[model samples]
Target chain A: MIQVVVNFTERTYNGFMKVKQKLEILADAAKYDASCASSGTEQRNSRNGKGIGSTTGAGICHSYAPDGRCISLLKILLTNFCLFDCVYCVNRVSSNVPRARFSIEEVVQLTLAFYRRNYIEGLFLSSGIIQSPDYTMEQVVEVARILREEHDFRGYIHLKTIPDASPDLLARAGRYADRLSINIELPTAAGLSALAPEKDAGAIRISMAGLRERIDASKDKTASGKCPPRFSPGGQSTQMIVGADASDDRTILTTSADLYGQYRLRRVYYSAFSPIPDASPMLPLQSPPLIREHRLYQADWLMRFYGFEAHEIITSEHGMLALDMDPKTAWAIQNRAMFPVDLNRASKSTLLRVPGLGVRNVQRILTARRVRAVRLDDLVRMHAPVSRMLPFIQLPDYHPGATLDAASLPARLREVPTVPQQLGLFM
Target chain B: MHTVYLEHETDMEGWRYAARQLIRLEVAPQEVSWCVKSAREPGIQGDIFAMPDSRSGSDCSSQEWAISNHAGREVVGISQYHGKTDVTSSTIFPEQLAPSTHADHLMVPRQFIELARSVILHQAPERFYLLYRVLWRLQRERGLMRLAGDADVARLHAMTKSVRRDMHKMKAFVRFREAIVAGQPRYLAWFEPEHHIMAAIAPFFIGRFATMDWTIMSPNMGMNWDGDVLQFLPGGKLEALPAEDDSEVLWLSYYRHIFNPARLKLKAMQKEMPKKYWHNLPEAELIDSMIAEAGTRTQAMLQRAPELPRRKIIGYKRGPQRPDITGGNE
Candidate 1:
């Protein structure tokens, strides 16, 4: 009787510790990734009494972490064990961080449980390369496959794909995942090779190009007009580590613009390098360039939405974005000659270049002007920042006057330090 | 002067009936007052007892008073009981009143109707009066909505925006806790909303969580789904439902673990999930401890030295086999 009781206690303790340790290790290992978005997928729901979740066109942030990042998905690694020696990755084989691997069942149960509680939209399953990239890829895809097919979970699933995995494996991954991303890791091939010796930049691009082709083919219909099977209907996205290597903001933007054009990517996430537990002797021991990351996102918005080219936005001599001011305001001040853009006569593209007027306000202006002349009060009523707009735009009742030429324009344009300018709130 | 009492706070049909009658009677918007039957207005209540004096020959008949009261309206007297005959005077029917009317004759924009539908859901005592005022003005001013700067149009837009925001918040914040009801799994959630939006937002939850049995309770209303049909319940003080479950345990675990100690943007997190919501969220219990430990954890990571590498534990051998995509068919 004594022996049986002791064994039972021992087994319970081990089981409890193993799951808790695994969660701590795996979640810590996965936190460096910046992509927690669960948006831009095909809208689906399980209203037929078959499944338990739904995905709308726009994703909802179930919670917000103190990192200011959204917690829309239960982002985690299938396992933290790795064979690759990516120096920047805390999960890299060379690192001394304690490792753990979650069983496939644990992952599925965790996702479903978290989802049922409305803690998450779905799973974003990633893994460190274990055994081989192919083996690791298969393990990751199996989690998604089980959640989608066996459980009939109609929620968002974003799988991180290994570029080295076989095309066949990639194809199957596309079938199950709403989104697939392969990290570019670094901006330049030299930077990538120097830091992550095992990763090949060429191979990553090849996989991206392959993914894009398959994504495009799936979207196209055959001559019979039959729709092809859905393959990543949410499209593809990629992430690049900003401060880990020697690449500057200009280089990063160039790579991002290229990726957006080449891969038809939905988003390019910039993750500022967070120093991990074990220090790399060669990397800089400074604060993570968070402001730089924020500015890059702003610059990216300009490129995608405002029609600003990558070459035009970079102002600092070092090819780095200005830390104090937003890229749009910096560009507007740099080209002061384009100031006092006539709100009545300026084209959509020119109006978009204004610092304060966002894409929505500009569209509203164009639409409203067709009906009647837009005054300053009309702009204010639309909730446009009149203080920011007064320096750059001319309305029927108001103009910049001499303020456009004032030397304090840059200081005035600079965002007040205390206020948090949320990036996507304007649009 | 005229008084129209609505049967329900959010009763659009009742509102439309009163509006059409008032317009037909040539009663200008300022000449009429609109109040809900259940609204807590003492003046409206006193107006009901005062109605007996306006009756022609009845000796304070309680039945006549009951019909006249309609939760209290002084001007709408015993004639309310004999409605179709007593109130239908040729003078009450304007020359423009036609059984079949054109949309152009109303001159109210389709936009104003959409705005009114959302605005009427608001709990403001003046909402009905404000909407009627806008509708009355729209007939004279065709381009009223186009003036986004106009106070009435702007107020209309503001109310609609507030209701829409509440609906979106409901969509984002409702957290369901799994419970066993009748030996079957049912999800229960409690939410506090600032507006009368439970009816407006229930269909979204029904459509989303259709397969699962669930109940969403708010201060104003409650909605329940039983796999096939959805039912509404009058809401009061919410009884403490099952607050903890195995699923919530894992959810809280994930929440505690997923937060990065390095980045502490408390303002941003609070901006989205305000402290008011933090009380109900299972994960929110971890937030204070997470914030407290974040700085120290970040410092420790920053200060830790490069430890000597441990012997790597070998997992699967990289065999000659490539991952077969065809394997998925099974």
Candidate 2:
């Protein structure tokens, strides 16, 4: 059995005990979660003098962490205590990490103070499973209720929903939260069974289906023409830990595609499994597959916005994405016949599939071409990465020549070593 | 050679009046130059040289005739020629022009107006001239604004983009520090913007931080709000704000702890949160140290052997028990 030494030098602040210590513990526990997005919420403001904060439609990142992660919301767990001993999790009951819990009032106060100082858009509250699922869920709901009803805080609140919690509690959570998420934890059911044995895959899906029903019902008007109560207008999102098990890139993306289609999830965050202190013997001791995780995110973006199917992106023999090159470039190289898309005449969909033409630049080409023919100079002025696109696109003044059919095309299309490799050794 | 001096820096009304008069008089764009009466040189009033004879009320045709007759000459107007400039008399071809010329003939598209809104907030001295130039050409070529490839339209778009970027940075970079005035909490932020965009971007701040009393101070102007009322103050300096505050300590703590040393994408980080903003942000001070120590920290994590898995300290009795596996816990 793991024995935790309670080593917190108990500090006091205005008769409140361990406030700073609890913040440290809880914030550390919450860091493992990858969902830091505060965007895509219902736009609101406290213009009426009734509330204390506002939420923009597209959320703002108040700060960027050294990891290049956005610090948009005050992401913290209610407590680090847990009943499940999930091996990948830092706060599993088996771990010897320090434990602390924030009283409902402390979370509310911290959220308000951080918001007042313009440090964050709003709160992103999650918790480890503790007590009974219902009891633990009730405590989480109370925090949101207090923030919403008691203080009229009209800020973005993202609550992590317990899959096993009752429908009433889930509905109550949806009412107060702008976005709600239930982490699928691992990609496959077998992975979940092996790593986080306590979590049920079927239960998670059932809960998602129920939440989707409520979300859809709330979006429409009733028969009497009365508006339904707002329910997670920012919609639901989920996270899947990447490189945690034998699940390959194809499997991970397939799971994400399924989640998006079934639950209509706003996002599926791919968290690279990072090494933790008090690590499990079963888990790999190597460095996290950060590059693989990044590739999966790029592939996910293709599936969501670029009309790429999960199978189309992972057409590699090993069912893995190329870590050295981006998925789009890899795809374009694999399908050499689809090269040299005419920038002037290609459809929006075809332009989107081009290696380096981003959605913004493609739209720019469409708009600019309406008045005059798009030329090389126009694309350069638009700041499109012309070198990356030049191999795959044809303009009035530019053509790929024999470059598209060349045997050395893949190597040519590869990202040039702009930064030296020694620095990458450390990263 | 007609230098039409506007009243103030962002005097769109003055620009509108001068443009209408000059366009009606059939004055070519190259013949006119737009000037704003500098704050130091407050010699005249009523949009200064706009209607040279100082017609204040609605009509400007009498002064328009004066401008046409005195072309290529300095026309100085004060508050002296109020109500004297007739609207109908200044046109180069008075009867041939449609009756709705003033109200409609010179009407630029809505896109031009929106573009002009951002363009006027630019600090470029030629912004007014460029806008009027486009406006003049727009009368003959109705589809001119649609051509982004055109140099004049492209310049207008570039100005709009710069102003838009400035506004976006103002929104992103303004970091409020907590202060107390009259025993109630107030927030103050200092930002350095590249354009005359304080008035243009103040509404976003007002709407976002509506309940709190806040002030967003910039070099050119300052915006203040006290829960209910939003107002503007004159320009301020960086010294106007305190260097540090209490809330920043916690904010910095959060920034430091949230950063994961293992994934250091410095180029990407610097792309969004550039080094130019480093001096203002409290968390930016830790960035250098974090990047420096990341190698050692990640190395330690990588080289360290996996610790033995800790046995469960607490258990949920109702949940599944351990299945018959080497390490599986149910």
Candidate 3:
């Protein structure tokens, strides 16, 4: 009797600790993925009181980690054990990190529990290749299926797709997921071969192309005017590890631009390569400047929203974005003839190119100019960066004059330090 | 002077009805004042029941008067009403000057209504007065609201923005703790919002957690949803909630492990999740330690010697048969 009681207690204790241990190891393994978006999904609510949760177009960041990333989803992996020997990956087969895997039920329960507590927008499920790519992909999709069908969960779901997974598994993943992503891993094919030898560059492109075609077909009407089944209604996105390869900003942006155009990708996340434990010799010992990642995001935004082409943003002989200034300001300085834009008469596109005018502020300026001439005071009220815009814009009450022609324009407008700041106590 | 009193801070219907009467009476914005009567305030405890007799000439029915009297304990003033036997006689228009019956016909832009709806929830004492002033000006200056450069319009926008942000934050930060109430599971949360946004944000929670029984408590208000209906109740002390849940251990573990020590932008994190909301958040307690140890942890990772490949190379090459690429399963 005593032995049976002891065994029972031990089993329960281990079972409880197993989940906690797996969560820590798996979540730690998955943290390197930078894509945490849970927005732009179809609007849903549990108003019928049948299920639990809602997604109202706009994503909510339930918490912000100390790393400054949005904890919008319960971003976790199915397992941290892998078969591939990716040099940069902490969970690569050869790496010495501790490994753990969660059963599908554990993931489902964790997602629903955390979601009910309003701790996350939804689940972002990714996994390392466990057996075959097909088996791993099936496990990831099964979690989403149970969340959607069994529990009637209507919240946002983002699944990190395995590019080498069978096409049928990819289709099922899209059906259950609001967004699906296949990480491009590196900017260039050479980078992939050097870093992640097992990952095929051609296979990644084929998967992306397949996703694009299905997404397009889902949007189209059939002969009877009936729409096809939903397939990643929020569309596809990808991530590329920055500074892991010798690719320049030009190459990165060029890849992103091509992905955006060719695959109709919703976003291309750029994660600056951060150092990991059990380091590999092939990887860099130090991380790229965090600001480099910030600059890349700004340049990516310029390409997406600000109507600047990738080549136009990075036009220097070194094929690099200015570390001292923003890509927009650098472009403005390089092509000074385009500036001194009239605030009152400038087109929306012209206003968007102004160094200090953001999309919303430009709209505000346009609205205010319709009633009366926009003055310096008006720009200040609109929260436009007056000093930054003084050289590039011509307000009705103010003009650039000699400021635009100053030889030290670049030096004067440089906001960030050219040299990277030392990683201090609190960066 | 027109002294119009509202029931509470977020009394939009009362404000609209009173403002429509004042606008019809041709009262200028400066001639009007707005005030809220809290239960703690002295005077006018008995006057609420007696005032309906003075407005006998007006079209306010006895039933409406009864409803307003029952709900008018927390009163807001449009003009100052001193303690007097006949306060309404001197407070509003004369008995002969009846409010126009066509008050609903008074028109403002749809934009003004949307702006006022958000602005009314602002904690500013003068929010109602500013809204009325804008409405009075809009009667003649039809394009007044469109001029974002105008000071009054800009202030309105700023207040609206603040209230909207407060609402959004309330939604983002209300962390629920599970508790057993009457042998059933119930989720409870505590939040302190900067604005009177409880009623405004109630629908969002209702839509999100419709099937779950949950309650969200603020300092002044509380919301409860029992699977089918949502009810507003008086707020309670934080002691009423569970101190912790077992699941929080897993959540904290996930929070701690997921944070990358290499990139610590405390400012960016603080910008979205400000320190004001730290005490209620269970994971917030880990932030200081996480940040304090970040630099050392990163240095360790960077300085750690690269390990040699230990495992044999498992070259699982793809076979000649490619995976089927046919698009749809159906």
| Candidate that would win on lDDT | 3
Note the DockQ of each predicted structure.
Answer: 0.32, 0.28, 0.42
Candidate 3 structure quality by residue, lDDT tens digits, B1-330: 455555556778767877776666556666565655431111123433233343323222122111111211223232323233453453542222344545365658888999999998888777877888788878777677777777778889899999989988888889999989999999999998988888789889989999999998877777789988777776568888887776776788889999999999999999999999999999999999999999999899888888776766577665343454555444
DockQ value for model 3: 0.42
Q: Calculate model 1's interface RMSD in Å.
A: 5.1
User: Model 1 segments beyond 4 Å from truth?
Assistant: A1-17, A222-224, A416-427, B16-27, B38-104, B313-330
User: Highest TM-score among the candidates is held by which one?
Assistant: 3
Residue lDDT tens for model 1, A260-357:
99989999999888778886666778755588888999999999999999999998789989888899989988998998999989999999999988
In model 2, pairs of residues that clash are B61-B86, B62-B86
Candidate 3 regions off by >4 Å?
A1-12, A417-427, B38-99, B102-107, B321-324, B327-330
| Over 4 Å off, model 2 | A1-17, A222-224, A416-427, B24-29, B38-103, B308-312, B317-330
Tell me the docking grade of candidate 2.
acceptable
DockQ score for model 2: 0.28
Candidate 1 collision pairs? A66-B265
How displaced is residue A388 in candidate 2, in Å?
1.6
Q: Judged by DockQ cut-offs, is candidate 3 incorrect, acceptable, medium or high?
A: acceptable
Ranking by TM-score: 3, 1, 2
